[model samples]
Target: MADVRSMCAIGKHGQLGLNGKLPWEGTRAREFREDVQRFFEMTKGHVLLCGPRTRRSIPQFAYADRTIFEIRSSMPPAETIAMFPNRVIYIGGGPPVWSAYASFIRHWDITRLPYDGEADRFFDPAWLCGVRNGN
Candidate 1:
Protein backbone atom coordinates (compact mmCIF):
# COMPACT_ATOMS: atom_id res chain seq x y z
CA MET A 1 0.00 0.00 0.00
CA ALA A 2 1.05 3.59 -0.50
CA ASP A 3 0.94 6.39 2.08
CA VAL A 4 -2.77 5.96 2.62
CA ARG A 5 -4.31 8.49 5.00
CA SER A 6 -7.67 9.80 6.24
CA MET A 7 -9.01 13.02 7.75
CA CYS A 8 -12.13 13.93 9.70
CA ALA A 9 -13.55 16.70 11.85
CA ILE A 10 -15.48 15.40 14.80
CA GLY A 11 -17.58 17.03 17.45
CA LYS A 12 -17.15 16.80 21.20
CA HIS A 13 -18.30 13.17 21.16
CA GLY A 14 -16.97 12.14 17.81
CA GLN A 15 -20.00 13.38 15.91
CA LEU A 16 -19.14 13.59 12.20
CA GLY A 17 -22.26 14.84 10.45
CA LEU A 18 -26.01 15.20 10.51
CA ASN A 19 -28.12 14.18 7.55
CA GLY A 20 -25.22 13.94 5.12
CA LYS A 21 -23.91 17.38 6.03
CA LEU A 22 -21.61 18.92 8.55
CA PRO A 23 -23.01 18.96 12.10
CA TRP A 24 -22.93 22.73 12.27
CA GLU A 25 -25.90 23.51 10.07
CA GLY A 26 -28.09 26.09 11.78
CA THR A 27 -25.17 27.85 13.42
CA ARG A 28 -22.15 29.25 11.63
CA ALA A 29 -18.82 27.61 12.35
CA ARG A 30 -15.86 29.48 11.00
CA GLU A 31 -13.34 27.08 12.46
CA PHE A 32 -14.98 24.11 10.82
CA ARG A 33 -15.12 25.87 7.52
CA GLU A 34 -11.46 26.83 7.83
CA ASP A 35 -10.55 23.26 8.69
CA VAL A 36 -12.46 22.00 5.68
CA GLN A 37 -10.60 24.47 3.50
CA ARG A 38 -7.42 23.18 5.04
CA PHE A 39 -8.43 19.68 4.06
CA PHE A 40 -8.79 20.74 0.43
CA GLU A 41 -5.53 22.64 0.44
CA MET A 42 -3.50 19.90 2.09
CA THR A 43 -4.81 17.19 -0.22
CA LYS A 44 -4.45 19.30 -3.34
CA GLY A 45 -1.63 17.25 -4.88
CA HIS A 46 -2.67 13.90 -3.45
CA VAL A 47 -5.11 11.20 -4.44
CA LEU A 48 -8.51 11.34 -2.74
CA LEU A 49 -10.60 8.17 -2.50
CA CYS A 50 -14.10 9.49 -2.12
CA GLY A 51 -17.38 7.62 -2.14
CA PRO A 52 -20.63 8.98 -3.57
CA ARG A 53 -21.63 11.05 -0.55
CA THR A 54 -18.21 12.62 -0.18
CA ARG A 55 -17.82 13.23 -3.89
CA ARG A 56 -21.08 15.16 -3.95
CA SER A 57 -20.33 17.32 -0.93
CA ILE A 58 -17.07 18.66 -2.34
CA PRO A 59 -16.95 22.30 -3.43
CA GLN A 60 -17.32 22.97 -7.15
CA PHE A 61 -14.13 25.02 -7.43
CA ALA A 62 -12.11 22.27 -5.74
CA TYR A 63 -12.58 19.87 -8.67
CA ALA A 64 -10.07 21.81 -10.74
CA ASP A 65 -7.12 21.33 -8.37
CA ARG A 66 -7.27 17.92 -6.73
CA THR A 67 -7.39 14.39 -8.08
CA ILE A 68 -10.47 12.61 -6.74
CA PHE A 69 -11.54 9.05 -7.53
CA GLU A 70 -15.06 7.87 -6.91
CA ILE A 71 -14.62 4.62 -5.03
CA ARG A 72 -17.50 2.29 -4.47
CA SER A 73 -18.24 -1.43 -4.12
CA SER A 74 -16.94 -2.01 -7.64
CA MET A 75 -13.49 -0.67 -6.78
CA PRO A 76 -12.39 -1.96 -3.40
CA PRO A 77 -10.23 0.11 -1.09
CA ALA A 78 -7.42 -2.37 -1.44
CA GLU A 79 -7.49 -1.94 -5.19
CA THR A 80 -7.25 1.85 -4.85
CA ILE A 81 -4.29 1.50 -2.50
CA ALA A 82 -2.58 -0.80 -4.92
CA MET A 83 -3.22 1.59 -7.78
CA PHE A 84 -1.22 4.33 -6.04
CA PRO A 85 2.22 2.98 -5.26
CA ASN A 86 4.38 5.54 -3.39
CA ARG A 87 2.08 8.57 -3.25
CA VAL A 88 -0.30 9.90 -0.64
CA ILE A 89 -3.92 8.80 -0.87
CA TYR A 90 -6.53 10.48 1.32
CA ILE A 91 -9.77 8.67 2.13
CA GLY A 92 -12.48 11.32 1.97
CA GLY A 93 -15.46 9.25 3.02
CA GLY A 94 -17.55 8.93 6.13
CA PRO A 95 -17.69 6.30 8.87
CA PRO A 96 -18.67 3.35 6.70
CA VAL A 97 -15.86 3.82 4.23
CA TRP A 98 -13.37 4.61 6.97
CA SER A 99 -14.37 1.52 8.94
CA ALA A 100 -14.08 -0.64 5.83
CA TYR A 101 -10.60 0.65 5.01
CA ALA A 102 -9.20 1.19 8.50
CA SER A 103 -6.68 -1.61 8.32
CA PHE A 104 -5.26 -0.32 5.07
CA ILE A 105 -5.01 3.32 6.19
CA ARG A 106 -1.66 4.37 7.52
CA HIS A 107 -2.56 7.60 9.32
CA TRP A 108 -5.69 9.34 10.53
CA ASP A 109 -5.83 13.08 11.13
CA ILE A 110 -8.88 13.78 13.30
CA THR A 111 -9.81 17.31 14.35
CA ARG A 112 -12.10 17.93 17.29
CA LEU A 113 -14.61 20.65 16.64
CA PRO A 114 -16.39 22.59 19.37
CA TYR A 115 -19.88 21.66 18.41
CA ASP A 116 -22.33 20.02 20.79
CA GLY A 117 -25.33 18.82 18.81
CA GLU A 118 -27.12 15.70 17.64
CA ALA A 119 -25.58 13.99 14.64
CA ASP A 120 -26.55 10.96 12.60
CA ARG A 121 -23.01 10.17 11.51
CA PHE A 122 -20.05 9.62 13.79
CA PHE A 123 -16.41 8.67 13.72
CA ASP A 124 -15.67 4.95 13.70
CA PRO A 125 -15.18 3.68 17.22
CA ALA A 126 -13.10 0.75 15.98
CA TRP A 127 -10.31 3.11 14.98
CA LEU A 128 -9.73 4.14 18.59
CA CYS A 129 -10.30 0.65 19.95
CA GLY A 130 -7.44 -0.95 18.07
CA VAL A 131 -3.94 0.20 17.20
CA ARG A 132 -3.24 0.74 13.53
CA ASN A 133 0.10 0.80 11.67
CA GLY A 134 0.59 4.31 13.02
CA ASN A 135 -1.66 6.67 15.01
Candidate 2:
Protein backbone atom coordinates (compact mmCIF):
# COMPACT_ATOMS: atom_id res chain seq x y z
CA MET A 1 0.00 0.00 0.00
CA ALA A 2 1.13 3.54 -0.68
CA ASP A 3 1.20 6.35 1.84
CA VAL A 4 -2.53 6.80 2.32
CA ARG A 5 -3.49 10.03 4.01
CA SER A 6 -6.67 11.81 5.06
CA MET A 7 -7.67 15.44 5.56
CA CYS A 8 -10.62 17.28 7.03
CA ALA A 9 -11.77 20.64 8.45
CA ILE A 10 -13.33 19.98 11.80
CA GLY A 11 -14.79 22.18 14.51
CA LYS A 12 -14.16 22.25 18.23
CA HIS A 13 -16.89 19.73 19.00
CA GLY A 14 -15.67 17.45 16.23
CA GLN A 15 -18.28 18.96 14.00
CA LEU A 16 -17.74 18.80 10.28
CA GLY A 17 -20.34 21.08 8.71
CA LEU A 18 -22.98 23.66 9.20
CA ASN A 19 -25.86 24.27 6.78
CA GLY A 20 -24.08 22.37 4.03
CA LYS A 21 -21.02 24.64 4.10
CA LEU A 22 -17.73 24.99 5.88
CA PRO A 23 -17.46 26.42 9.36
CA TRP A 24 -14.35 28.50 8.78
CA GLU A 25 -13.25 31.69 7.06
CA GLY A 26 -11.25 32.20 3.88
CA THR A 27 -7.98 32.40 5.77
CA ARG A 28 -8.56 28.99 7.29
CA ALA A 29 -9.52 27.61 3.93
CA ARG A 30 -6.35 29.00 2.44
CA GLU A 31 -4.29 27.48 5.21
CA PHE A 32 -5.85 24.04 4.71
CA ARG A 33 -5.40 24.29 0.96
CA GLU A 34 -1.81 25.35 1.34
CA ASP A 35 -1.04 22.42 3.58
CA VAL A 36 -2.69 19.98 1.21
CA GLN A 37 -0.97 21.49 -1.81
CA ARG A 38 2.37 21.35 -0.11
CA PHE A 39 1.83 17.76 0.90
CA PHE A 40 0.95 16.73 -2.62
CA GLU A 41 3.79 18.75 -4.08
CA MET A 42 6.27 17.00 -1.85
CA THR A 43 4.78 13.59 -2.62
CA LYS A 44 5.20 13.79 -6.40
CA GLY A 45 1.74 15.13 -7.09
CA HIS A 46 -0.43 12.46 -5.52
CA VAL A 47 -4.10 12.58 -6.33
CA LEU A 48 -6.75 13.80 -3.84
CA LEU A 49 -9.33 11.10 -3.43
CA CYS A 50 -12.69 12.45 -2.40
CA GLY A 51 -16.41 11.91 -2.76
CA PRO A 52 -18.57 13.87 -5.19
CA ARG A 53 -19.82 16.16 -2.44
CA THR A 54 -16.28 16.78 -1.29
CA ARG A 55 -15.10 17.37 -4.84
CA ARG A 56 -17.73 20.04 -5.33
CA SER A 57 -17.14 21.56 -1.90
CA ILE A 58 -13.54 22.33 -2.86
CA PRO A 59 -12.73 25.87 -3.90
CA GLN A 60 -10.66 26.83 -6.94
CA PHE A 61 -7.54 27.42 -4.89
CA ALA A 62 -7.56 23.87 -3.59
CA TYR A 63 -7.66 22.43 -7.06
CA ALA A 64 -4.73 20.27 -8.04
CA ASP A 65 -4.18 17.27 -10.28
CA ARG A 66 -6.89 15.42 -8.38
CA THR A 67 -8.86 12.30 -9.09
CA ILE A 68 -12.29 12.70 -7.55
CA PHE A 69 -14.24 9.53 -6.87
CA GLU A 70 -17.67 9.05 -5.40
CA ILE A 71 -18.39 6.73 -2.48
CA ARG A 72 -20.79 4.29 -4.04
CA SER A 73 -19.63 1.10 -2.40
CA SER A 74 -16.94 -0.32 -0.13
CA MET A 75 -14.65 -1.70 -2.82
CA PRO A 76 -13.31 1.49 -4.39
CA PRO A 77 -10.95 2.71 -1.66
CA ALA A 78 -8.86 -0.42 -1.63
CA GLU A 79 -8.79 -0.33 -5.40
CA THR A 80 -7.93 3.35 -5.48
CA ILE A 81 -5.23 2.98 -2.87
CA ALA A 82 -3.88 0.04 -4.75
CA MET A 83 -3.50 2.11 -7.87
CA PHE A 84 -2.24 5.22 -6.12
CA PRO A 85 -0.80 4.15 -2.82
CA ASN A 86 0.53 7.64 -2.35
CA ARG A 87 -2.98 8.95 -1.84
CA VAL A 88 -3.96 12.23 -0.24
CA ILE A 89 -7.60 11.66 0.55
CA TYR A 90 -9.91 14.38 1.80
CA ILE A 91 -13.00 13.20 3.69
CA GLY A 92 -15.55 16.00 3.61
CA GLY A 93 -19.16 15.14 4.00
CA GLY A 94 -21.86 13.60 6.18
CA PRO A 95 -20.89 11.23 8.97
CA PRO A 96 -20.89 8.09 6.85
CA VAL A 97 -18.05 9.00 4.52
CA TRP A 98 -15.82 10.21 7.31
CA SER A 99 -16.30 7.05 9.34
CA ALA A 100 -15.63 4.83 6.37
CA TYR A 101 -12.17 6.13 5.54
CA ALA A 102 -10.95 7.60 8.78
CA SER A 103 -8.86 4.60 9.69
CA PHE A 104 -6.77 4.42 6.52
CA ILE A 105 -5.95 8.09 6.69
CA ARG A 106 -2.46 8.77 8.04
CA HIS A 107 -2.46 12.54 8.41
CA TRP A 108 -5.11 15.11 9.17
CA ASP A 109 -4.97 18.92 8.94
CA ILE A 110 -8.00 19.79 10.98
CA THR A 111 -9.24 23.39 11.24
CA ARG A 112 -10.48 24.50 14.58
CA LEU A 113 -13.34 26.93 14.25
CA PRO A 114 -14.88 29.00 17.00
CA TYR A 115 -17.80 27.48 18.82
CA ASP A 116 -20.54 27.99 16.29
CA GLY A 117 -23.09 25.94 18.26
CA GLU A 118 -24.78 25.29 14.93
CA ALA A 119 -23.03 22.33 13.42
CA ASP A 120 -25.52 19.61 12.57
CA ARG A 121 -23.05 17.15 11.16
CA PHE A 122 -20.39 15.20 12.99
CA PHE A 123 -17.86 12.49 12.43
CA ASP A 124 -18.70 8.90 13.30
CA PRO A 125 -18.29 8.17 16.97
CA ALA A 126 -16.82 4.77 16.28
CA TRP A 127 -13.92 6.27 14.40
CA LEU A 128 -13.30 8.87 17.04
CA CYS A 129 -13.46 6.28 19.78
CA GLY A 130 -11.07 4.04 17.92
CA VAL A 131 -8.60 6.86 17.55
CA ARG A 132 -8.96 7.86 21.16
CA ASN A 133 -8.26 4.33 22.31
CA GLY A 134 -5.37 4.02 19.90
CA ASN A 135 -6.87 1.20 17.92
Could you say which candidate leads in lDDT? 1
Candidate 1 regions off by >4 Å?
25-27, 128-135
Per-residue alpha-carbon lDDT of candidate 2 for residues 1-135, written as tens digits (9 for 90 to 100): 455555555666877766666555343556656644564554344566655555576666545565555564455556656765445555444455555656666655554545445566765556643242222
What range of 10 consecutive residues in model 1 has the weakest lDDT sum? 126-135
Report residue 25 deviation for candidate 2 (angstroms): 5.4
Query: Which pairs of residues collide in candidate 2?
Result: 2-85
Task: Give residue 49's lDDT in candidate 2 (0 to 100).
Answer: 61
lDDT of 1 by residue, 1-135 (tens): 378888888999988878778888545568877887788878988888877887887778887877788888567667778887877899887666776678777788888889888999877667744333221
What is the TM-score of candidate 2? 0.63
